[model samples]
Target: MSIVGTEAYPQDICSGGGEMKNLWASQRNNKGAASPLLHSRGGCKGKTQDCSLALSPPLGSVSLKCLPLLEARIVAWIGGPPASGKSTLALRAAQYGFLSADCEPPSSGPDWLSGFGAVGMTNRVLALANASSWLLGATTSGMVVGSCYGEWMPSSPAHIMRVLLLPEQGVYQQRHQQRGSTGWSTDGWRHAYRQYRNSLLVWQRDNGTSIIRIQDRPNETSCPDKTLFDACEGIMAHLDKTPHELCFYCRRTRPPQSAFWLRCPPECLGREGGERGGAGHASHEGASFPGASSPRADSDHSSKVATPAEMEEIKQLLLATQGGRLDRSATHNWRNPSVPGRYGYHSIQIGNVNLVGQRNPNERLNILRSFLNFTGKVVVDLGCNVGGMLHHLAEVKHAYGFEFDPRCVKAATRIAEIFHLPEHFYQANLNTFDPNSTFRGLEHAPDIVFVFNIGSWVGQWQQLYQAIANTGVPMIVLETNNDKEGAPQLRTFRDMGRKVQFISQAKDDVTGNFRRKTYLVTPA
Candidate 1:
């Protein structure tokens, strides 16, 4: 038995200098059933050629008879326009044990994949392919697949992460040109790109889809392939988390029951509601603001403003220290009784400036509060970007932050001075950081040490862990890059003769994309 479907382009247009033809065929023999295959036929120059590609597992890899025992489920759906690298991402995800299937919409009708029609068609296609049983025993992570469009509403009750791949317009067009596809006109492709761009925001808000923007740049740090791989790894890590472990708004791990509700507590709800103008806005009104402020009262510095000369000097200092980028390390705003104007990345207002950052340091502080007491404790923060967390820990005896970036150190120092905070910032690269020598002159050891989202960057984990252990610090609070990194980090801690326990998987509000696992390390 064979199942075949053909996608044909208009005669006036061609792909690869010829009419584009896509054939999806699956064959089954008496011995077993072969996985589906996708074939493309087009002409280059004057000659017509056929290109056969196996888009799924090999024919005999998993027999049809074993379908009943398999437990495959769709973990993620990758959606984008043509040439946005959707197929490449799908294939890459398959390497990590995710079954991949290409479910393109019919070529003739635009409305075929709209609303319920799209969801129904996607379900039918996956059902026909036996997607649930494709590679059950092979890997537990399940599958990641989708169509060329950027909208999907799956009927499955299982959580399906929606990822939209949007490349730069120039890159999108260039990809089509490089493939020599003429079946679709430039105007048509441009229109599709515009539509995806315009509607993606609304779609994302409605469906909670994560959008990954792909840019074509020369920098190796921002390579599109690496970005996609990181995204895939993030999805895999997300699958390991239970529904109650992550927050509904931020997707970070939930704090313990003693602290608040497992999902989004009132704090997160207030923030989310304030951003989207949802009912959560009412929650924000009743929520107590962070810091030394009384309930529902204006901040002490609300009516204060920096002198004109001080404001000018502050601007110059910010530019010089932050290299003209106001957002870097400006996690919290310099609000209250200072110069007025919205500046920086975080949304909180400090003085007069509004730092519109994605992650709230206050929220992180609340999570940490649930774990340990900070009253009158000396704290050491490793890789403290701009001293956001240190600033919020006003109850601590004193806060010492070691940062790698000299510019960040300067910015953090200035902010501390401005607020009269009992915090100090120093420059030290954690890769070669030594706690023994660094803390030698201190009168007392830090009560608690915070290492957040910097373990992966520290090349000498053994040396660093050993030095930290030697410090005789009572507690070490660490936030790893992801769930996968937690085990290896814990092993390193064990090797260094320290007892490390996972606290929870928390969202690093800084980037807001990756969910990091938090651990508490104590001397053995």
Candidate 2:
């Protein structure tokens, strides 16, 4: 059987090595257009020449015994709104043995044939031919790859996969805000998001394209790594290809050179100069703050045992500042590390005076740590009295506290300044708390919000919850009052129609009377 004029040919005919090779050589010598079969084998090199290979054999002249050798080439175009993790997913696909390139122009490189531009279509098409699989980070609307560059695609539409990540609007907006770039305004971002959705719909209906949509659950925080891995798996399944087994150390398909090694030759144990390999990079090895074991601590001084004179001075300062009274219902039993038996107004180590609060902040922190990671994350503590919890959470990138009492706020501020902690405190009534106003000067949105045991005390808890919800924070740790008073609070929270995931219930280790329940609140 003979195939002509860019028509699809059977696998056996297309895979005839001698015939295909002779045809490709003849076309190259004559400067004629290259065949898709030749292109699949990277025959074009870097040329922009046209494709014009001809199969002129008589019907039945070609034998049917040719072994099929050419694997279908695939070019996956990944599209989504800005900050939807398109670039991240493309790079991840590269780690999984796929050739990857971004559609955006290179920021610092030779600008030739930049980023799927019209002039670069030939180059990109040649790239598509060279790799078994290519993952391209597409433009917002994906029209560049789907329409403008359609002519440059492989002959089989089945080989061009379009994947669109459609995370919830709130999640998208939150990611955009975290990027801290001024490239797009709110209106502009919304417009681009809509354009992507509309374009995908049109491609599905008009082109009969099978579009893959990766969507995030409502109010759930999207994990880019997990999303990217799932997408790569989906693409592999769609292509009827098995994913390569990756090395445990490098996360690559290359096999280890030695039976005792977990990493490939390029990623051998000693190659990284004692550093950890691949994405599991080792964290910096020093303490980040004073008296804190966390690597993110930011203080210069270590926990030094305060001399008797310094302790007396600290005691006098606490007494003179707030008349030595615990502002909130719970006592701020700050403790000295040297004397574990003693407790004080706050839990902070200041030149040896370890002010340990009555409520074991570490105990509460352990519960929160199990649910959320504080390392390099922004935290907002609602009704943080004397900064007990926030003080202990020094590992966070930045900690902000809000308390209704001015005295409590002042004390919290004093503690932070003395300890050289990266924390800020403000006095704000919970009834009218506004996240935007509270976090006005912040560069990033809060990652975790704490509303511990303050629902019953705040008269307008609903308003506060609504305000926090509007911020689109991924996690909210809410601890209700004791069972009796907390029942109404819990019911009210549920009535607000938010998704409340029960975390755990434990007795108030500090108060010892109430068994409080902790829950995670997310948008529905």
Per TM-score, the best of the predicted structures is 2
Off by over 4 Å in 1: 1-353, 508-511
Which window of 10 residues has the lowest lDDT sum in candidate 1?
277-286
Residue-level lDDT tens digits of model 1 in 1-524: 00011112123211221211233211222221222322211101121112222233222212221121112233455666665666655553443345665555434434322432234454342231223222221234445665546533221112345456655556666665554334467786777667567534424333332233333333222222343444543443343342211222122222342122332335333222112210000011112212221111111221223456655554554444332323435432112112233222222223343243334454455446546767557787877766767755545655677776565566666655554454566666576666876665444457898887666656666577767877788999988867676667778778878888766554423344456777888877
Q: What lDDT does each candidate get?
A: 0.46, 0.46
Q: How do all models score by TM-score?
A: 0.38, 0.38
Residue 203, candidate 2: how far off, in angstroms?
48
lDDT of 1: 0.46
List candidate 2 stretches off by more than 4 Å: 1-346, 349-351, 507-510
lDDT of 2 by residue, 1-524 (tens): 00011223333433333464466556665534544553432212243322222232222212111100001123566665656666555543333334455554344445333421223443343333222111211111111121112222211111245566655556666666665333557786776566556544433332322344566656543343345434534443433321111111122122333222332333222322112111111111211222222222222222223457655655544443343333445343211222232243343433345443334454456445535657668887888876777766634666767776655666666655554565766666676666766554455568889988777667777677767777778888888857787776666657766778776665324234347788888767
Global fold similarity of model 1 (TM-score): 0.38
TM-score computed on alpha carbons, candidate 2: 0.38
